[model samples]
Target: METPRERWVGADAGPIVRPYAVTRGRTRPRGMDVDLVTLLVATGRTPGERVWLSREQRRLLELCRHPSTPADLASDTDLPLRVVQILLADLHQYGLVEEVPQAEPAGRSTGRPDPKILMRVLDELRRL
Candidate 1:
């Protein structure tokens, strides 16, 4: 049977678009590796329009601004660790963040995922 990963077709290659925060940076992408924190703050600018964020997503973004373990972030944010993992994966895939590997999960653990998986998923999404 085909898996979710195998089911993708196309229509997902386009860049991801998300609203930014209050602060932003000046340099353009052609000049430098974008600072995600600065870029996040720079993306949203609808003069009179309002921006909204859930308490959890906001907290998740804050935790992500620093290099931290998913377990640590989940504990700090009071969210289930798995949910934190999922959110980070989403953020990374959208090019809003990057991740570095840490210790491996214990044998009894469900196991951590590889960030490269998102690249494959992104390609599949593009194909779909």
Candidate 2:
């Protein structure tokens, strides 16, 4: 039998709040498309005193002060990628963060990769 103090605070103890709890039982982001490479930047707007924010969410905002990707944020926070995406979506809804649009190459109207580059990659792979 473990004492209350030992059970509550121990070297082997896990996080007090589980990942699902942090995300409010949500596995996917709502109304936002967040990918691993999606760039996110803080909107420089502070949350009001009336607004509530979780510890993880605050930390995420701090990390996003400098534009960062979901993958980078996940690695920095040591959280799962899905959790980071959900958090980002929440921040976006709150107007605390926004996605930075990636610039397109010149003369490339469509987002698809160039076929010549694909052919070159295939040839290189076949040679290996």
Candidate 3:
């Protein structure tokens, strides 16, 4: 049988550190809502001396210099989506990052669709 070290010694070996280790074994972001389309931007506040940031966290901050979505951040850093969300939540808690409010689409006033339009669509579906 091949030793574990020998088995993982080649270029084919996967990531050295697992995602759980990076997030300290936390599977979810704390008290923060994050979704694929949710926009995130840096708050322009620098981390204080007391703040301890991991390499991944620093990389996230750099990527958030401009408005970014969690999906984009994950893709850019080549990290898992959950890991990015957790790191972003930490930055958000520190006030180093903020969520950007999405604007309503142009030519739309209310969030709810018109009842009449919905009824018509339903009627069409029923006909089908």
Candidate 4:
């Protein structure tokens, strides 16, 4: 006796999994700190070698093999943001993955370039 709301009348009708369950009731990421933009990549081998991880963690490892951010992983996997961060930190602890900080683009000048440097560049261009 389930209503339409309870059963969304689709082939993929299943109970929604809570984030707490995914994280085993953990509230915060351990040791490592992560943000939405923090990039992660696998360590060239399977993570959680001696431990059993949730299905979500395994999927995250696969997704991060080529470098992915926590935001992207959360959006793509439909997992909570905090949950993803905790999972990533856990993997990092096990040496299954590493955090790769994104660097600011080099092309962007913090402020106006030094007038002397610009003048030199202009002079060099004039010579050519």
Candidate 5:
């Protein structure tokens, strides 16, 4: 008999679930768009009070109990950015979390770091 293809196993030897399964075949989120640094805050809903939330959504609530960025959430959750974004969107629809984009400083709003700030930091590092 031929052996089946190897399956992914976790540290506990549990079968690994695919990412797409978690999103229910969604490749994109349905609500507000999010960037890497979009801040998220939990709505502080207690367990058993949440209605029809997925495990990913619950985990997102726990992680965002303290203000955190989507990038941070992805890193901490070991999930892809898209997956986290989708979860955040779901939480948003349920009013379980809020998305706040990081405001860029007035002068640096054009997407480039100010050269003066970089020079100052370089000078300080050289002095140290």
Candidate 6:
């Protein structure tokens, strides 16, 4: 059994998906899976509907429309790269944002990370 409060915002605060929409996989062949911008925009129901986005989170949501890098977001928002990384992690967990995996340069191949690494990292970080 679950309490109403447990099922509320404290439980989660990610984008709300439409019933008929088939959710897309957030993985990529390269670096990391970035957040899904189109879905986030579509989830914002009304102009006045509050989504409880932090300033940086809002800027991140706006900037991720084109697969932005955390460095770029840090520069644009005047936030530290580490801080942006933290927020992005949170957004990704709530299914709001995803990591955009980038390929290494030609002749410079690094092995792709196991998806479990990302999942474990996210789970551990969420407790903070």
Give all candidate RMSDs, comma-separated: 15.9, 4.5, 6.1, 10.8, 6.0, 12.9
Q: TM-scores across all candidates?
A: 0.37, 0.76, 0.75, 0.69, 0.68, 0.43
Q: Model 3, range 1-128, lDDT digits (tens) per residue?
A: 98787665656755467889999999999978888868899999988889899999999999999999999999999899999999999999999999997777689878555699889989999999
* Pairs of colliding residues, candidate 5: none
lDDT tens digits, residue span 72-94, model 5: 99999888899999888888877
Best by TM-score: 2
The candidate, 3 or 6, that scores higher on TM-score is 3
Off by over 4 Å in 3: 1-10, 13-15, 106-128
In model 5, where do residues sit more than 4 Å from their true spots? 1-14, 45-50, 101-128
> lDDT tens string, model 4, 1-128?
98866764445846677778889899899989988778899997654447787799889988988899999999988888999999999988888889875555578656345688889989999999
Ranking by TM-score: 2, 3, 4, 5, 6, 1
Residue 120 error, candidate 5, Å? 14
Error at 91, model 3, angstroms? 0.4
* Candidate 1 per-residue lDDT over residues 1-128, each given as its tens digit: 97665455335633322223211221123222322222221122222224343455567666666666667776786555545555555445444455553456566354535568868989999998
Lowest summed lDDT over 10 consecutive residues: which window, candidate 3?
A: 7-16
Query: Candidate 5, TM-score vs. the true structure?
Result: 0.68
TM-score of 1: 0.37
TM-score of 6: 0.43
Better-scoring candidate (lDDT), 5 or 6: 5
Clashing pairs counted in every model:
6, 0, 0, 0, 0, 12
Which pairs of residues collide in model 3? none
Q: What TM-score does candidate 2 get on C-alpha atoms?
A: 0.76
